[model samples]
Target: MTVTEAEGDTAAQAPMGSSSYSRFDTDWLSDATLALFATGGTSPLFATSSTVEVRYLGTQATREASLSFQGPALFDTRSGCNFATALVDEFCLIDSIGTARTLGDLATGTTLDFTLTAQPQPLGSPIDQRASAESFSSLASARWIDLGGGQYLLGFEEGNDASYNDMVFLVSGATATLPSPALPVPELPTGWLLAAGLAALAWRHHTRR
Candidate 1:
């Protein structure tokens, strides 16, 4: 997932290392499950870093899907930045029409096509002397929760804290959509450099507490 400027601008052409976007695709492993493909990318001057992961617990079949994001970086070195990792300015979820949709049931092994996007709050001011301050979604993971009927809950990781209250999506029928809520593009100081590798593999550390 390479970082790109808002409004379909790539990071290479951006004026400064601020907001960006990326897109990824994955497949469905179950009737009610969508494997959120893992991806990681960096911005110029290493100003922003991002990683995502989603998987299923059981077996099933489906087709390829896509997800996108349009917001500031989640990991930043500017603690004093304005919109850095604020959530309110960021948003990410299954991108679809309307507010809600359905995905049938998992027990029946009914696969469906869909798309999801992850967005964070708007970009904040550049980092200041507060270099020690760091903001990040290290635990940016997601899972599916059965809500009975054709509705399902899509939960995502949030904050540095070990909590699952970050974001949720409800699928009611064959389609599922989530409202763009407040997302934060937190700024964090650089410390240990993560070993470079595949996008999905590089982000495993971010999942750890």
Candidate 2:
């Protein structure tokens, strides 16, 4: 495996260097996409970073969203400098047909294709051991949930936190990008990344204690 493709530790998952979205593709929130134009995509969100999960999907009666993050760097806000290690923004294409919103939650038939670009550390060293208060640029992620038979919502959240409650998301039925994305963010994992889109259906709701 190439140096970039290798998996790193967690602590760096959350912006604050916590352990949340640090699992492999099978993990709850650790989603990796290759770069589009970069000829090669980088694992921007790889390693010790924390990720969040919703105990309830868009199908959960739209009540208080059952969301939770188990580490630092977890975010939830409109905008602000994030615990992200890089200063790059991500891109995605919605393929359904709801409100044509930029980002939000996902519904049963709702689908979106997004990409991420990991900024390589100076010496490839793990970051945020202590999760310094050094606020850099803000990072964001969007998702679409399947609320049972054809129901959907698109959700987008900025900043990093450990709360997935009542956080508004997008409605589904919006025509989004294709599952087998023609382009990736960093430009790696051509086959596997595309597989991820197809496998997104396996995610089970995460209930926080």
Candidate 3:
């Protein structure tokens, strides 16, 4: 099926750092929603079941982002599932804001690989840009936030802005099999270390005196 705008009269607003021509209009998500899920943790996600449900949460992107999926360990065979035919091939589930769609039940043990294709601009010679969770080279393009209870919040950064709020989705029956980004270790500055060393030497000299 083709992607179409959701029903309802909605107003469009330009996302931050985007031109007027690029507008997103939807109410399913807001800044608070993004903040709530921002710290939920991120990692490469997989479908726990063949029957996965997806809901278009919202978008804050300049380009038109569409959702699709391929499955049964097609992207990463090392994920461990037996080789099976792709459950879905580039199906357009959501192409606009506030739309929700579900994929038909797939074979059990099928690991899902989600993709988001950025449609070409209406006025320019831009070509379709695609990003997938299976592509480790550009893993930053897609992020999966575990929402717990077999649900997840998937977001895509369709452009260089790195605002994953571009195309947000609420997915059910998914889990993160990979580790999330770890917090950086804290370390003292070189000046602090030098001062500590000098203080220790002074203390020793005082004791000897």
Candidate 4:
């Protein structure tokens, strides 16, 4: 889905570094919080430095998921930046929380592609599902959020539930350029707007029950 900017002279572009929206509650991290472009298309993350750090934030899914990267210099064995050494073949694991890994020798200003795979549990189907940043086959499986300062939040939706909170990670030294259009900022704090949206969702869910 394309996110278009507003028309007319009053439309202002979001700042380059920080997200257009406000900070989300920490509790939302444990649950399926709203993502800026949850149902829309995502852009590739570009490396800002020769080396980028990826930290496992946390996962709320029951599936055994693994995160991997694919890029021009990522798996090049000749550059000594092979998948096994330069990049962690399995950078983040479902059970390995709060762990961080560095991807070295990445070419600056280039896209760093990512793939998230969800392993089948004993009780679930035996098929392994995959989501990719460069592929549109599973567009809803992955979501990217700019957290400013060359940091981004990447989330994946492993199951059909549409909760992109299955696997969440923080990537530093990388940036993603979204195609969203400029929006008019209201007088209220951006955080309050985000909170109000969440409150509405919660209230709707509560009433349904």
Compared with the true structure, what per-residue lDDT tens digits does model 4 show for residues 145-197?
77679877777666666656555666788866532434777598889999999
For each candidate in the order shown, give its overall lDDT on alpha carbons: 0.26, 0.24, 0.49, 0.49
lDDT of 4 at 4: 20
**RMSDs, each prediction?**
25.2, 24.8, 16.8, 22.8
Total clashing pairs for each candidate: 40, 81, 0, 1
- Tens digits of per-residue lDDT for model 3 on 1-209? 12223333323322322322222333445455555544445555655655666665555443343466652111111011111111122221222334445555555444556666554434322432333222221144666666689887777666565556556677777677732445799999999999999999999999999
- Clash pairs, model 4 backbone: 5-181
On a 0 to 100 scale, what is the lDDT of residue 8 in model 4? Answer: 19
Give every collision pair in model 3: none
> Between 2 and 3, whose TM-score is larger?
3
Give lDDT tens digits, candidate 1, residues 84-141. 3223333222222112212211322222222332333233333211223222232234
Per-residue lDDT of 136-173 in model 2, one digit per residue for the tens? 22123444443433233333332233222112232223
Cα distance off (Å), candidate 2, residue 66: 24
What candidate 2 gets wrong by more than 4 Å, as runs, is 1-140, 162-167, 174-209
| Alpha carbon lDDT at 22, candidate 4 | 14
